[model samples]
Target: MAIVELLNQDMKQAMKARDKETLSVIRMVKASMQNEAIKLQKDALSEEEELTVLARELKQRKDSLHEFEEAGREDLVSKLNTEIEIIQAYMPEQLSDEELETIVVQTIEEVQAQSKKDMGKVMSALMPKVKGKAEGSRVNQLVQKNLS
Candidate 1:
């Protein structure tokens, strides 16, 4: 099923199960997707576009999670963790380190990226292939490791 339909189905199940956290997270994601569609002036988002929205949402929560941890806000940290899990459930399966490294190396080769200076070229060629499957930072790190 398309992500939107899957989300709708999951939202109904969450409502039926009285899963407040899941329901809230689903609503938030749905709203984000809707907002993105409006911003693009599209009636619906393509699958890639949907993944972009999910990625943005996941990244925001993860960034917040890090800040909360640094601030020693345990309560908020736990809450954000839950939210992160909920958001991640809707994302594509993540790439393992080995797989991500392989792709990064291949992209670097494909782009003829010889050093960190070519990082932008490698990333531009790499991201679309690995989108929704790997975290951008992790990919960047792998690229750097292989480059230098």
Candidate 2:
């Protein structure tokens, strides 16, 4: 099923189960998706578009988690972690380190990225393939590791 359909179904399930946290997180995601769709002047988002929004939400949660931990805010960190888990459930499986390494190597070769100066070329070549499957920082680290 498309992401929107799946999210709708899961929302219903969360409501029925009285999963307050899950329901709230899913509702936030749905709202964000709808808001983005409106901003784009579209009736609905495509699956790829939905994934992009979801990815941004996940990244935001990750950044919050880091800040919460650094501030010694265990209560907020725990809450954020729960929300992160719920958000991630909607994302595609993350790429393994080995798989990411392989892709970075291939991208480097494809883009003829011989030095750090060609980082943009390698990143442009890799982003489409890695989108929704891996984090940008992970991809950048792998590319740097392979290129240097």
Candidate 3:
């Protein structure tokens, strides 16, 4: 099923099951997807486009969780972590370190990234291949490690 259809079905199930956390997270995802469609002047987004939005939302929550922990806000940290869990359910399986390393190596070679100066090109070339399957920060770190 398409993401929108899956989301609608899940939303109904959440409602029937009285799953407040899941319902809220799914609602947020729906709103974000709709907003992105509007921004791009499209009536509906493809699954890949929806995944891009979902990935970004999940990243924001992860970032917030990090900040909450750093600030010693344990209560908010727990809440954000729960939110992240709910959001992550819709994302693709994340890449393992080994897999990420392989992709980075291939991207560096494909982009002819011989030095740090070519890091941007290497990253640009790799992002599409790894998108929704790997974290951006992880990809950046892997690329930097390879380039150096």
Give the top-scoring candidate (TM-score). 2
Query: What is the model-wide C-alpha lDDT for candidate 3?
Result: 0.91
lDDT of 1 by residue, 47-137 (tens): 9999999999999999999999999999999999999999898899999998988888888888888889999999899999999999988
Task: Estimate TM-scores for all models.
Answer: 0.95, 0.96, 0.94
Instruction: Tell me the deviation in Å of residue 33 in model 1.
Output: 0.2
What digit string (tens of lDDT, one per residue) describes model 3 on residues 1-148?
8888988999999999999989998999999999999999999998889999999898889888899999999999988888898888788899999999999999898888988999889988999998899988999999999989
User: Clashes per prediction?
Assistant: 0, 0, 0
lDDT of 2 by residue, 1-148 (tens): 8898998999999999999999999999999999999999999898889999999999999999999999999999999999999999999999999998988898898878899989999999899998899999999888888778
lDDT of 2: 0.93
Clash list (residue pairs), candidate 1: none
lDDT of 2 at 11: 93
- Name the lDDT value of residue 37 in candidate 3: 99
Which of candidates 1 and 3 is the stronger one according to lDDT?
Answer: 1
Model 3: CA > 4 A from native: none
| C-alpha lDDT of residue 16 in model 3 | 100
